[model samples]
Target: MRDNQITKEFFDWIRQGNSGCIFAKLFVLRGGDTPWEASVIRAETFDAPTVEAIGETLKLASKRSEAIQLILPNIKTPEQIARMISCLCKNPNWYCTEIIPKPSEYTSSFLAGLRWKLPDAVNVNWVLGFADIETMPPTRRAPYTSLAIRLGQPGTAPSVAKDKPNEVRSRKKENGLVPVHLADMPTPFLKDDAIKKTWVLTEQTAGKMLNPTPEFRTNAHAKVTFALPMDLRDSLIGCFTPVAMDSKSEIGAEEY
Candidate 1:
């Protein structure tokens, strides 16, 4: 199927309120310098309200992270800065293929708080990126944290790419889902040539991307879940405006 057609189908699926369908939001950052850099700062499943709230947060965070990158000589790579922000944000869903740095005293507190806040059922797969074997964690533990390495050779690093939010938004509009992009919003962060964008995938689309073949069905009994860490939740809640609902009205209520 064509890319546009697939996007249309995804939008329709989201609109239909299909069971097991979730909206996966990805925050992508890219740079224009010679040694190119691109990284996904945050990726999480969002309910409608959380999506808008996160868009605003991403604008602020992107600017802040970039500024910190300029000041901190130790933070050279996008992945390094991303990891630092992940710790500060206490975002458990932060994905990185590189070796995550050992948390500093300040960041360690954030990491511990996040680990403590994790629900008993949620599992974290920790990938060690260090070249030295001695730095690796010795064992996996509960809340199901597993120590491992990212499989396969690392792919070529992502370079600065053109903004495609409009294309995605138009495709989504054709099938009835509202598409939100960081680029369209008014913010000081977008002044630079860096790439800022967000795209959502329905659970069905996410499944196809993860496991494209009919023969490779994921176990029906298996459960996979992700939770936002405490710090991020607190930060977003502070910024989010809650909509008031009438006690008597049962219709038009948002359910997560």
Candidate 2:
């Protein structure tokens, strides 16, 4: 009964925008049937809100002697924090407010990366106030993260199309397969010569070319190619194909 009350309070605190870590520790020390299942808590939600939820969940699980290591800084962004809160909100059907802060150097690309995850149209409220900014805890995280190196030898190259990935049938899901080269919106104001030079050097270094033609660099960057199913490759490239530009100020930024 006491554990149930704690669980309810912990969730309440999160909805009220309280940081989850403080409560997380308390729950961890409780050591009983964790309010949450480890399988439900992703390795990714280790920061403020989610971390708190995780801590509570872990505490319960520890009682049963079935807990794992707590991964830190798992909270990546405010949206992720908000999403978790939204997910666990008592009003389970509440729609997320779409919030888009203008892109700036100070804003983490992490939030911008969440654009696709948001509901189609979101309401953006100014979440920061002058006093709030002064009282906010300092984040010790590095802006640039070093990607972990994958262990073990690379897999042997596949031999046939039967081994290929399934074909994408919808434009909506096709964005996931967008080719990496065309993933970023191409810069137009930049010189073509400079773009070509960089592309040539990169291709040569990566051994992407077998019997390269003079126009290969331009074509390679402009279109997509791969060893996968041709239909999948086409679907991927089509996602990034530039629509006609209507005005000088209308460059569509590719959502990474």
Candidate 3:
């Protein structure tokens, strides 16, 4: 099938409400070389019924031997993956999501090949997955996975946070002062001066940091400083920087 045709089918599937993860295959043929590339796209905002229709629609598309893949819902187990492969092989554009390196091999290949170049706040790697396969072509031998951080308005797709994996879940649940470099830090909305000479920030909590972004400081019209001895200020500033602010994030907002 053509690229435009696959896109049309994708949007149509969306209209029908089949949301979950989708596998996309793209094939380009020139001269004797036929390059096949496959990717995974999790439905950021489709419901179950809609996702079902998308699965069926994709099955039909694969039959045409086009460069597109559609991963239907309810195919979570290895057996299910086998069934999916059987169904997809009928399409001339067959490519495997699984490759040797390990659980993340295919996903790593996709990111390296595509180099998607996303924004700073959104992490896309967390959303990719791969299937188990027996053999793969040399060019296609590497495993492939695809994930994205949505940049559109929040309401468009329920928010990616709700679908984060357990690793992320653990990170969110982590409270207490986790030692972090001063340079690498999350937005610090919470901070306090335990002593005239010491400043403390909590990674486990939300809002209120001692030294917030320069913009926040200017906006709040508050004179802010490290509150450390003058001689130590420059050295502390270069350390992994944490933030301090006087506002609060909404309660339980981290869940989503």
Please report the candidate that would top lDDT against the real structure: 2
Instruction: Give residue 171's lDDT in candidate 2 (0 to 100).
Output: 17
Ranking by TM-score, best first?
3, 2, 1
Q: How many backbone clashes does candidate 1 have?
A: 1
Candidates in order, TM-scores: namely: 0.18, 0.19, 0.20
Worst 10 residues of 2 by lDDT: 123-132
lDDT of each: 0.23, 0.25, 0.23
- Model 3 scores a TM of 0.20
Better of 1 and 2 by lDDT: 2
Whichever of 2 and 3 has more TM-score, that candidate is: 3
Model 3 ranges off by over 4 Å: 20-117, 121-125, 128-149, 152-256
Q: Which of the two candidates, 1 or 3, achieves a greater TM-score against the reference?
A: 3
lDDT of 3 at 177: 13
Residue 169, candidate 2: C-alpha displacement in angstroms:
13
What lDDT tens digits, residue by residue, belong to model 3 across residues 112-191?
A: 10011112223211112222222211111112211111111112011122232232223321122111111111112212
Q: What would the per-residue lDDT of candidate 1 be over residues 101-192, giving only the tens digit for each residue?
A: 23331111111111111111222212211111111111101111111111111111111123332332222120121211211222223232
